[model samples]
Target: MILYTTTPIEMIFPCDQTVFDNYKTISYQGVPLVVEQTDNHYRIVQILSSNPNDFMKEELAPGQLISFI
Candidate 1:
């Protein structure tokens, strides 16, 4: 039931298993993502890796700090 903005124009609704124990990070197709909590929704803060594939997801791409709000 969690929503994340992985790309500038897209959002990824990952399952509960994708959420990390810390609740600050999540795995989307194996890419670790950090998110910032907004008043109404969550925003993509950063990618926890430098791998090109990490930012290649249609939803969570580099330079695309998408917000669900």
Candidate 2:
């Protein structure tokens, strides 16, 4: 999964869907998401949004973007 970190999209290990609980919205800009990527890699884009409609679940792909409230 990838997330928009102002500086860069820091990749984490063991990106299993089960680790979603370990992700905290307050600590992160968004939630734990599962995205489909055949390349085994993804890109993170940073965009400011209020009360992001995104919720934590699974992983997210390059196309998936979350918001932070």
Q: Pick the candidate with the highest TM-score.
A: 1
Each prediction's Cα lDDT score? 0.57, 0.37
Clashing pairs in 1: 6-59, 6-60, 7-59
How would you encode candidate 2's per-residue C-alpha lDDT over 1-69 as one tens digit per residue?
666554323324446655434333222335433332223333223323333554322233235434432
Model 1, range 1-69, lDDT digits (tens) per residue? Answer: 554644523234345543432236666557788775545555566787769866667677633454544
Model 2, position 39, has a per-residue lDDT of: 36
lDDT of 2 at 63: 52
| Candidate 2 Cα lDDT to native | 0.37
Tell me the lDDT of model 2 at 23.
Answer: 35
TM-score of 2: 0.19
